[model samples]
Target: MSLEIRSLEIRIAASTDADAACTVLRRSITECCDLDHKNDPAILDAWLGNKTPQMVANWFNSPTNFSLVAVSEGVVVGVALLTGAGKLALCYLLPEARGQGVGKALLARMEEQACSWGVKALQLHSTATGQEFFARRGYVDAGKVRSPYGVETVFFWKQLDAGAEAPDGGKRKRFCNCNPV
Candidate 1:
């Protein structure tokens, strides 16, 4: 299903969104990231083993992390998490949401959050399938690293502009009222 990018609602993920966010994480890994896992049972299991709803809720509630979800027609289509230490820990989109700009929206928000937190640069370990996406967004390829799941992962980093502001000139709609400590 093709979705209009403007129609997606990107907001801070809440505990209530854990189940849907977990589903997005798992499905995106198992279905969309075939090249990284190669349908290997062991790899898939290891990668998805801890992606449970409870874990997602814990991530959402973490003071050191900023988590966001993209919703389309009341359904969560994508999820992303950014750490206080400048790590883009998670960014995944539902299979049908790929190439629909949802990922870009989630990423932009994460960058904004990073800037707000005084992060100088953002980094992430990208799967083979996500390398190009990060690259196109100006993330530089640092090198390759072996993932815990025994997969080759690309390391990407992007320097955040110190003066960066939201696209709306700091008037961006506030979806989540919680303040990041």
Candidate 2:
């Protein structure tokens, strides 16, 4: 079997890329999910409502949330976000970008950030379309949850900086020897 794999560049997202970020996330939630979810407004809102450009900009407020975009042929085709408290906010790849390692690379970037920030653990609420992908990356389902928008989601988690250092989300609460990201 063969597939055309395009060259991709993954970079930390700037505010300038917010629009493209929204597009990638919208496509991932709307175009990649199952028929039922695709048709359900509640699901759409739950999965992507808070991912718009303005919403993403607001997320940038805390300085803990970071966004990254994966570009292919100068087009934004994938995006991932990590929020404060080491939460994996959103991760999505365009249909054409799937299975081409874009998602994996994007996720690795977030994981690397978490490890560097002294984040003790990372978590995310995954949809059916994304559960397997997260599982493949050492994330295990902690449980299922319902989002504010009324959509059921699967929760996954990973631990980082286990030994002696972890950030308690404050300047002086450092418990372990933190690694620079």
Candidate 3:
């Protein structure tokens, strides 16, 4: 059953969104990323060890990180984080939100944010489940590396046209209708 996202909002995550965003992050890893974790208790536990609400809140509040959440019908269905060093730190969506454009919207917004920040490129370690998604979005695979959780991950990077400036003069563009609230 596909979830028809009638009203989806992408916005900068606030402290109050930590709980729901954490839920999305955990659920996406546990449920949607079976290929990466393979239902192994040890790997799952290690990967999820620090995915607490408090940690998520800290990520949202960090000055060096930009966090965003995808809300559908007032529920956080997706979460993404971009580091100031041009790393695409986190990008995950609930299982039901897959193939629903939420990931694309989140990624587009992240790229826009990176460009606004004068980031020349965005880099990430994509799990098996996310490799194709990132590839389809123009990310080039650099090589494979074993994640800390023992999962084989692909390193991907995308060069951005950072020379382009937003109409508002270097501010992030609302490319995917994402609000920075």
Candidate 4:
């Protein structure tokens, strides 16, 4: 089945919006991200400690970072952050907001923003739940790395040049063989 949502707008996130954005990110990490933490309270605490509103505000104030928020009906549903060096810093959505094309839309908008800045590629670390999502979008798995929060994350990267197409004029390959748990 196809899911469609209305009134979804992606816009640059403002510093004043950091608290709301941080709340969404914290909730998403503490709730929907069990694929990595396995519902362990200690792990959740350690992870969420870094997702404070102040950190989000710092991201908002950073000159080299581009932050975007997805809003619907005046509520922030998702957020995407990227650095000028093409690092896909953060992409998070509330639990009820998942599997409804929010992340895909956010990623597309971020990619467009990066392309406008002449960025040729983007790289990110992903949880198991997010690995398949990124893979489906043509981000090839580069390997695994331990996150600062002590979770093993999959590293992925995708070239953003020429509309993500191969030089041979064929469609780009997707690494989406992962089965969702």
Candidate 5:
């Protein structure tokens, strides 16, 4: 099933929006990413601990961070944050928002912002669930990273300023919208 995303809005997230964004983020991590965490109590606790509403709010208000939210009908369905240092720090979407192009919209906004900030490259740690999403956006895998919580993440990087060719200077095929009609 896909969401009828009429007029989805992507914008910078404000501190006051933290509560709702935190709910979406936490739910995406705990429920939407169950395939990776497997409902392990320790892993869930470790992952969820860092996403407290207050902490997320602080991140929203941080000077060195830029956060964005995707809203449809006034509800924030997805969230992403990028650090000033060019790290695509986080991206998460509610289960209902997946496969509706919300992630791609959020990613494009973040990448544009990064380019405007003079970022030459961008990097992110993607979960098993998000590996393909990042790949489709031209991110190349660097390798795997294991978190202290025992969850393994894939490292991905993309060159923001590379022009007329892929960062690796190889011919690249653009993503095709292959969803069946």
Candidate 6:
């Protein structure tokens, strides 16, 4: 039977999810990006070529940072994180789950957290492939940026309204993939 795409339940990740989130992240790097696990034998041998579990932990451990996990039918398929600098820490989806609005949901949640934290702008170092995605969502290009691995990453940022504070009574309603036009 085909799985019907429904609204994913997003919540603050627990400590147990730390490891799973790592796996999802590294795997996404291999699957989503064209970089091959076989290419550059030396690079493959090294750990933390781009992302690592410890990095994710450090991100989650930040006081002003917020990470959310997207679960549908009890399976975690997507992860996202927003930093105090308004940086988009980590946003990924399983290859099978792409284009089903899962990324939209994840991004919406990230924006929601940003608004709650009183963030004025959202910044990100995105891949060339991800530039269009961010651009479509109102993010403007800042310039070329280099990642730790020496890959050229594009910098993008989006302005947010300062008036919207975190909904004290009900925060979940603010995370409905409802982008302002």
Q: Write the per-residue lDDT of candidate 2 for residues 32-70, one digit (tens) a residue.
A: 876328577766676676778887656544477787889
Per-residue lDDT of model 6, residues 97-136, tens digit only: 6778878878877887776666767899887657777899
lDDT of 4 by residue, 1-181 (tens): 2224577888999998899899889988887889899988888888888788899999989999999998877888899999999999999997778887889989998888777787777899999879999999888899999998878899998876654567598855433222212
Q: 12-52, model 3: which lDDT tens digit per residue?
A: 99999999999998999999889999999999999999899
TM-score of 6: 0.77
lDDT of each: 0.88, 0.76, 0.89, 0.84, 0.86, 0.71
lDDT of 5 by residue, 67-158 (tens): 99999999899999999999998899988889889999999888888877877678999899899999998899999999777789999998
Clashing pairs in 4: none
The number of residue pairs in model 6 that clash at the backbone is: 0
RMSD for all candidates, in order, please: 6.4, 6.2, 6.2, 6.7, 6.0, 7.0
Candidate 5: Cα lDDT at 123:
95
In Å, residue 158's CA in model 5 sits off its true spot by 0.3
Best by TM-score: 5
What's the C-alpha lDDT at position 4 in model 3? 79
TM-score of each: 0.87, 0.80, 0.88, 0.86, 0.89, 0.77
Better of 3 and 4 by TM-score: 3
Error of 1 at 61 (Å): 0.9
Expressed as tens digits, the lDDT of each residue in 1-181 for candidate 1 is 5555557899999999999999999999999899999999999999998899999999999999899999998999999999889999999999989998899999989988887786767899999999999999888899999999878999998767544455567733333322433
**Higher lDDT: candidate 3 or 4?**
3
Error of 1 at 4 (Å): 5.7
Q: Give the TM-score ranking, best first.
A: 5, 3, 1, 4, 2, 6
- After superposing all C-alphas onto the true structure, candidate 6 shows an RMSD in angstroms of 7.0
